[model samples]
Target: MDSRLAQHLLRRLRHQAGADAIDRATGAGLLTERRFRVAGRGVRTFVPGPLAAGRSEAEIARILERHAFAGSIARDDLPGDNDPAAVPEQSAGHDRSKSLDANGLLRAVRRSAEPLGAADVAAMLLLARSITMNTMPLGEILEALRLPAPIMTITGRVAGFEKTFLDLLEQGLVLPGKVASGEGHILSRDYDIRFSHVSDARWRVVVFAGTELDPEERERTARQVSLAAQSRYPILGVSEDEDRLPAVLRQAAGINLVSGPLDLGIIRDTMRAVLGQVPEGDIPHDHASALTLADLALAIRSGTSAKRALAVLDDLARIRMALAAENENDDGAASGKDSGRKETGSKTGKNSGRGNPGSGSERIEPAVPTGTETDRFIPRVETLSGYGKAGDWALDLKEDLALWRAGSLHWEDMSTKLLLSGPPGTGKTTFAKALCNTLRVPLIATSVATWLEPGYLGDVLIRMSATFAEAEAAKPAILFVDEIDGINTRGSAGEWTTYWDQIVNRLLELLDGSARSDGVVIIGATNNPDRIDKALLRSGRLERHIVIPKPDTEALVGILRHHLKGDLDAVIATAPERETGRTDTATADSTEADTASIATGEPAAAAPRRNEPAE
Candidate 1:
């Protein structure tokens, strides 16, 4: 029994002599009130007796009251005075031969212009799409699809663009995203005559949200947006910058114009406009309006094209009839389903017991591949010396790589493995690659975090060993480990042991250079060496520690001399051409030497903060 029916029956039973006690405690979540009893065949207040309780005025009144209050659909919305089996009559203006009843028979052979269900939603979306698609019965679009009943859920998702724009401002970029579940199927069903639904076709709705866009970046983004939109779903570019957005999006795929805080207001107005009602200063709750085709066209058509605008007014009458037919289909489907549910104990169709699509049994994302894909080797480069000759940095690195590549008979004396540590942009990774370039060897780069992506501890250790094996395959090569401090045990205490301790131990065994390939050189680069485990930093694995510092005045001058050769004359000299503009190399080199004395062999790129403003 329905909750209201149960409530009414309980209230009536409460007035009965013996049922007073049960009624006193009835105001909780208890669904039903029952008592062991045997009432007569015509009893109206008991279960399994409604079938025999015919012609009783009290029972009939109670059933009618329940339908009026507790129905899924409001009783007033149902057709034919709430009669389940009643066939509706045709409109006065409907054509005699154009009968659209369930069997193509006359709904009564008379017709008059009626209203459409989708007209409201169509108008709302048209308002969202804003200016262009007026006077086209655009609001009645869904009613045109597969005899569609317009029941679209329109949500003006301002959060998507607001968060997107602000995030881009933070990153110094406002990128666009794709629109997954809008447009096509909806448009197809709603405006089937003008546009057929293309379910598989999806285009991106890229947002361009910044105050200004770089010419090159803008060009690139525009090209990507167009190509993607043309081939797939039309891009609905949501723009926030008022001045720049209109011009930039004039030729773009699709655009929605909205101001930051006023976006919600714009959507509300558009929905009201589509629903054929005057937008109130506040949202309106009265869902009834009498906007005819002429009224909507007058509202939508922005220009003096009254002749063309009135031409489409005739179509609205047909639209109203079509909408009514589709609505009858909707009502029938709902009633049929309700009847089925009432008769059978089990659910049927659509959401029947196959289980909810969005349940918790989703699969975990696949782990990163620890095989050949990660083993890609970096090519050899010229020299790190040009990057910074703080201590003839390039020459010393080249010599080390050359000796190792030559497979020196006394290779152990060379101490193949080294650790490079310094502040960012100190040329650690660059110098490591330069070392490989000079040796004419391959550079295999991997990080500890990549190995740990497999989740479990045992898997990470195996991944770590596999990386070393791949590096050994390209023996006499530099294995550059970027961000090696990720496995540091500095903060790993009693509880964190389950993580860092295992990784640090496995890394120690892999560092034994002599036991495996003699040519395998492990060069770990990090900004913080203090965080690494002391045992792994012992005299064998990562035997040498190199510190890369910012360039000093002299080193900066040298690095500048090497790069800004011709550019310097342009910068400093205002005088006319000098064919023999030879610069003094020795003076510039000594100028660098005099300023700072760094650990001469630790080859890091120069990062001098000579002109950087103090923080």
Candidate 2:
């Protein structure tokens, strides 16, 4: 999985994809092949370790895909000439604005065979991908797709204001207006869509009228959105004693204005009022360019700076509940409903602030889309308890956990950093899960063993980074790094010492509070805590330690009853007889019987008791 080997394999894939130049160069040994003699077959160079013995193209492709996912074989390594359609132009280091033209973009989107929507226009225009634009660059191939905020604009003078028609014509909406000498000079090209100003003022307007919209409704909705914009912004209204304009325009979210010339100050201010200075998130593909230009124009006009406004909205129910409680305390319970009016406006169009009102566009959260695999990271049933033993230690955890969840104090007050160390299978991992359950957060677990799977230093480092990134993205969660002992730097005195040093450094950086932004708590679990780097276990890191001992005689009986689901009263009652010996794991017979003897005595009793004083 080294860079050179990954490149070689990628070249092979490109060659198989019918890249004549790559095939010729590969045959010429420009991309030399290294051979690994595995299982009586000389597996060619660039083959993933698991598939080193694989001789089939399909197997090699699968391994190559895995490497691509692991961030080793980059997207640039793939050939684009063979089938540019199959290999999307958007990839590593590829800027869409350079390669993307409207024709190819429209063709790619239409190939998806999905009913398109309002939201798709912005994605199409920019050639950008997002959570909504899933499997993209490939295109969105879905059914029953719906999008909010259909774009439209209008003018004051109904038929005379030909300036509005130019926007449509340039967008490929209308053909060149037919007129004589007084008509506008027409600029036509076979390119899919382009935007510019037309010179002719008295030109005939003919909308291209594509099948994207239904015949009847298409022209009608277009007219509505178009004429309204013109009517609102009278070109000759300002400075000259022309038509009088409204003194103020109400600001509504989600209403994006097309960027261009603002002839009058009122028109400029009106556009700013609706669209705001921030410009919000992605515009529909068809309109992203126009909207971007529009934002730049507004930014230049307005002296005010813009800030992103996508913070958490207050819950209406919570506000009502608090209001209701206060009214009841003041002896106004019977008449509270008449005077207590709560306004929970939509996040997109309507605002709690008062202004001129009309029907507003509905808004939805654009990023981290719902119904995706990564949406809900938390994993626990409502009934999540009994993982911890019945004692002051467990009670203390519960007490702080409640305060932490209720936002009563800074999360750091509840031990943001903690270490859970114990013998294998002694509920170390279980405690990690239980901790998340106690806090009602998601559990994102990764291990040093899993990171080493790629069998390359850089590949493992990439995996580690990706895992941490996942935990970071899912907020208010717990990150559990299991088998952390694999990262031990104690006995490393070889060529790999420098390699291990990098990994330990990266791990420390992530857990050092330098990388975390969310309410994320990290828990590191290991059987041999003594083997871990002392730097990692120091204060401001995993400084708080909890040692989980082997399930004792009493705990073992409880475990048996829970698992059996049958009559375990007999087992619990007679469990005291087995006090002569108990295993760390239920099947501790796998370990030396001496551990059973030692665990049955003072060590088992002392570990649980020591945890109490630490708490």
Candidate 3:
């Protein structure tokens, strides 16, 4: 056998034995190193015969196997049972009467005073057993323990191997190893055993119990162990367990598992948990009746646009009447049930007559028998203007508005349609409304979504015709279709062959009819003008294209002041010089023209126009 292996086995055997007892058993007869010259040429070293014959190899192997450290020792190399002792003086006090005599060895180990507890012994055995099977890696150990990988290293003083061993020594279970140069020789260390029959099963059970714990709790314990280990061993604490979470928390406690049907009782209980108790008399009981004709009249005079205002009033009235009827039915049902008798016709008549003054004798007519008079009071044509960014653009758009207002831009004779294309939110819709307001005519606003209703192809044409008829009746009206590109965009062949072609054809026909001698302007607003149908932009249709761009700094400042009520001084301070120059030049020209016109005693015929695009 290799000398190193022999030495390691000898150390392990000594650990199993009691080193002090071994020394006492041998007394001063124990071996000492001796060097002697051989043939006057070489020197040789040897241990004396008495110490060498202290224990047979078989006895050593048996002791190691009993302690579960057999891997470091081998049993087959022992001398046969029949063979006589090689050194008889070492076996002088041998007791052949006992099956195994470890008294000397035990005494020696006890003298060394190396102590190990049940838990430590178990852990060591488990490590040894696993290593014997070539599975010493911590990953496999954690798998056996059924733990999620630690997020951090296990550490601490109380739970680690070195601390546990130190604790054993303090408890008189271990004695200090050999010391040299003021440091203990770790290789000479050995554990003292108090019991001879330590069962592997008992040790395994203890280890299993220690390892079985909640994952988070296990991680905490591991960290404590690592801290303990670091005090003695130069170990880099790295997690070795896998990080995967378990699919089912089979051992989890304190959570309710619901796997059955839920009914109204469960729902009520859940609501109670979430919303708490309902108070008495919290339920709604009173409600206002529908708006009468008098109420509608009052609302119409309240500055709300008459038609829209009436529509709102009518809707509210209908809802109130429906609710009142439902309440009446509920009351009747409760009264009938309380009476506890079949309701006769005479009794019902009497009850109904008492409940309602004119019941059964007269009809309850709605407040308005006909909406015609209400319609007359409401303006058939109405317009709103001067709002948002579009209103600012409309100030510049006044010339176009004037032509329609003067009846010079008749719908039937005109060939060009109006294209108001601009960036979104810059008030395209507002400009369209302003134009209608300036013309003193109602707007017929339509967009692609409104026109493209399912199964409404024919209805679209009819609606278009009706709109034109309304505009002609109410002449000088603006027909504004916001997001015009949505309806008239270029598309793939399939779309062009199907929905697009039909929609475009209808729109073109409507544009042609509307852009005629009778004053009606077909104003189409789009962010993407390039997507509009070419035919619609042809002369005598929507030929006039007005592009609205971002406002200049002066215009922007003016818009900001209008929208946000900010201090103009701060804006003026930060205003670019180029914009100031333009403003100055315009003001100078206006002043010169004003002076000239005043000297001549006639007002200026024309105002100076801005070169910037309207936005």
* Residues 528-572, model 2: lDDT tens digits: 998889888887788877777777655564444344333333443
Runs in model 2 lying further than 4 Å from the true structure: 1-398, 514-518, 566-615
The residue ranges of model 3 lying beyond 4 angstroms of the native Cα positions read: 1-416, 463-470, 488-496, 565-615
Q: Write the per-residue lDDT of candidate 3 for residues 1-615, one digit (tens) a residue.
A: 112322343344335544433333234333233567788866643343343244543443343334332222223333334445322234456433322234444433244332222233322322222222121234453353343221111211112333332333233332223111111111112321122232231111001111233345544444433342323322112111111111122122111111101111111222222223211111010111123223323333322443444355446556766876797677667667878654434332113322111101111111222545333222111222124344444444455556755777643443325788888876676566545545445566766655554333433433344344434433445667667787654354464555566567656755655544355657788999988888878877778787777665334433444443234446445544434455566665555554444333345444456775323
User: Which candidate would rank higher by lDDT, 1 or 2?
Assistant: 1
State residue 326's C-alpha deviation in candidate 2, in Å.
59
Ranking by TM-score: 2, 1, 3
Model 1 over residues 150-199: C-alpha lDDT tens digits?
A: 11111112223333333322221211221222322122222321222333
Question: Model 3: what TM-score?
Answer: 0.29
Candidate 1 to truth, TM: 0.30
lDDT of each: 0.40, 0.38, 0.39
